[model samples]
Every structure is written in structure tokens, then in C-alpha cells.
Target: MIQLPLTPPGQTPLRVMTIAGSDSGGGAGIQADLRTFAMLGVHGLVAVTAVTVQNSMGVKGFHEIPLDVITGQIEAVASDIGVQAAKTGMLASSAIIGAVADTWRRQGMADTVPLVVDPVCASMHGDPLLHPSALDSLKSQLFPLATVVTPNLDEVRLLTGIDVVDSDTQRAAAHALHALGPKWALVKGGHLRASSQSPDLLFDGTDFFEFDTARIDTGHDHGAGDTLAAAIASALANGSTVPDAVAFGKRWVTECLRAAYPLGHGHGPVSALFRLNG
Candidate 1:
């Protein structure tokens, strides 16, 4: 059994952790998560599962972190700093996913912690981030443990084998994903074809809620998913309900995308931290 550290001095800050890959370009993955946590007034911790060679243009390759190293990071942080809520993104293989699931159960976090699972399958430029063979493990081992599962249209199709092109399909996909285990399912409709509004569908096995924002015309959204998931986890750590957390995350990410500036020659990252100009 893993024993967590007691809260040490002063007013205890909300604590959140991100278990994900490292994006070298600083646009997505752990980088986006940390930025969002700080922006939302949470202390962020990370356990990197892989390192990707990526830029604004694309992901060239990746190297998975050793399982021992991954477990060590998670154990070190969980035992000492502790976590109120956590989020997972871009587990590159079944090995990493299984390790994470085992670690969570071992630490007694599976049922108690608020865990947001972002089913990140690929990069913005069509590079695969997760191994195809790991899909079963993700669905069987990790999905059942998630407090909420966030999947974009592409991921919805990938995970559920349903092409999510319209509202009806989106709802069906959300239900299908919900059946796999999460207490709530949020299907992000950002890439829906010919849609004027980007609508995200949230279903908590009983009720359905839709959150929509005007589709901003921009290509500088390299780390949007990571930012959204991190923001939701941050909100959860700060004691928001699932619906409220999703709403806050959506609003924050929309603003970040709106204020995004070109950083690289190719597509740039959304501004997780907006500028404070006079």
C-alpha cells in the first residue's frame, strides 16, 4: 500500500498531476498541462511516459520512458506531494497504460481520485501517439477507472469505431464510450465537418449537456486537447463538479486559442498563458 504525505504548511494549494508524453516544441503534452494548472491556481506534477520529437509541423518520432522510471516518478510525487485530481494523456503503448493502471490501483487512487482521461491517439499533424495494439488495454484497464473521459471526434471514431459526423452520431458515440466505463463522457466536436459551431457533448450516463463556442478560424492550435484536459483536471482539483469543470475548461481553452500567436513556421501552439498587456 502506498502511503501519501500529509499536507505540510500554510494554506494547502490544490494539487494535480499529469501522466503524459513530453512534447519538445512546448505546445502540447506535459508542457500544456503544467501551464494550464498554473493558470488555474493548482500545483502541477508530472510523470512523463514518452518523449516525442515534434514541432509545429509534425511529430518525427518518439522514445518511451522506461517503465521503472515512469513508476518511480508517479510514486515519488504521489507519496510526497500528493494529488487531488489527475489527468492522463498520450500513453504511447499498452505497457505504459497498464503500468499506470497498476500504479493507480496500488496507490489506492482508482476509486477515490478524480481522474480525467484524455484519449489522445495522435498529434495535430496526423502522427500516431498511441500504439494500435494498446487500444484494448486503454479501453479495458484505464477507461473503467476514469471519472470523466474526453475524446475528440477522431478519437471517438478511433475508440468506438463510429464515424462521428453529426449530432446524432456524436451522442451515440458518447453513449458507447460511456458504456465502456467512465462516469461521464465528453465528446469534443471540434473537427466535425461543415459545422459552424464547435459543440462538445457531455453525458453523465443520464443527462446530456452541450457546450458550444463559435468556431474560430485558425490553425495555431497545436496543444488544444492537452490544455483542455489539464484545465478540467485543474478545475476538479479546485473542487468543481464535472459539468462545471468542463465548462471552465472549455471557456479557458477557447480564449487561449483566440489569443494564439504564431510561434513556429508551421502551425503554432494555443496560448495557454495569455499576455497581460496594458
Candidate 2:
């Protein structure tokens, strides 16, 4: 009998964890993150921070998971299956943020894994998603541990007290945010201009990368920021460097927006599977 050659051990897929709220509408939050990870060919794991009763129109209501439960979920994922990179969105309370930071520190995973903080404070329809008190905790604890923080203009204003009206102001705001200790800061420009092109600024401590894309003039963009940040985390988990990951993420989100399909009565989600069909 001829002996067959034995196959070597299979390599594990890049694992990414999303700590965020659940979007029942499946347009944003954990749902969007998982979809983005799947599109990027990575294993997506989730630790839901809260559950929102929402639809395309607006958030109806929300129930935040207790701090201990949040901590347990993070611990369960990090200690057992492990993660290459993690991204957080919609951390509802100051207690939750504090607990999450503590758990990450205790696991010694704070320094090893790349953490992307989306700082999702509110919904697309002007409803608050995070508690007002959580801002201080996020700034003090989570920001310092983040590998990258992806914040929109309003979020940047809230975090750094800098109102970004133009490109120069955006640059100044990015620099100020970077000074808070995150290794990199991505200031999203989606909310900035409707007439001009949309440009996102990425600051890596010393240098700046201005990513400009033709703004897709469409109403089907409910979860664009969440998708962008998740794509970045997925790229990082797949071993892409910071700048390359951000670049690819920017391109991916732009495509998603360009290829978006209107789903709901109001703002719709981007087509996360656009690349799959390409």
C-alpha cells in the first residue's frame, strides 16, 4: 500500500472582536461589523455591549448590558478564542467603558491587540447612544489604549473640544486627538461637506494621510462609519500595517457607499458584499 502524504495543520483565520451594541435593523453596530469582517475574509466575534430596539427610521429604545456582563463577554472571548484586533462602538455607560478597559488591562491584551475605538456616541437620526458621563471615561481610559480612534466631526468636537469647519481645522483637531495617546487617529469627513468632496484625515503621530473620495450623493449610507472602522480592524487582524489598513478601509467604505442599495424607508445600509460580486 502506498502511504499518502499527511497535510500540515491549517492556519487559523484572522480573528477580530467587535464590542458594540446590536442593531436589530442589521444596518449598523455589531451586525455591520460582522458583515464587514466576513467580507474581508476574517473570523468575526462579538461581545454585545447593549441591545437597541431600532429601525431605519431611528432608535426606539435601548437596554444596556450590565457592566459585569460586558466584562464577562470580553473576558470570555479574549481568554479563550483570542483576538488579533478589537474594535468598540456604542459603549453605553461610563461603568461599561471602565470595566472593559480594566478587563483588557488584566488580560494583558491591552498592548498586544490593536483596538479601534469608533466613539459612537449618537445615532444617525440624532439620538444619543452613549451616556453623557461615558465621555470622560472613554477619554481617560479607552483612548490611551486605542491603537486607532475613528471619530466623526461631531465626535471629534466632543472629545477634543475642536470644531472642524475646514481642512485646516480638521488637521488641527486630528493632531489634538492624537495627543491623547492613541497611536493613530482617523478624523472622518463624511459630515463635513456636501458640496465638496469628502476627505478623511489619518494622523500617525508624525505624518498625515489625507484620503479623499468622491462623495456618493446618496441617502443609502446609514452605517458607513461603523463599516469603515470594522474594515480597518479586519485589515489589521489580517496583518496590514496601520496606514495600509486605513487606506484599504477608506477605499472599501467608499465602494460600499457607491454600491449601496436602499433597504428601508429612511437611510439604508451600504452593500457590504460589493467586493464579493466584483
Q: Identify the candidate with maximal TM-score.
A: 1
Candidate 1 structure quality by residue, lDDT tens digits, 1-278: 11112244576777899999999999999999998787666788999999999888899999999999998998999999899999999999999999999999999988778999998999988899999999999999999999999998888988999999889999999999999999999999888875799899999999999999998889898889998999889888777899988988898888889877797789888886673331
List candidate 2 segments past 4 Å from native. 1-11
How many residue pairs in model 1 have overlapping backbones?
Answer: 0
Please provide TM-scores, in order, for all candidate models, with all chains considered together.
0.94, 0.94
Residue-by-residue lDDT tens digits, candidate 2, 222-257: 888899999899888877888888888888898889
Clash number for each model: 0, 0
lDDT of 1: 0.89
Note each model's CA RMSD in angstroms: 4.7, 5.4
Clashes of 2: 0
Clashing residue pairs, backbone N/CA/C < 3 A, model 1:
none
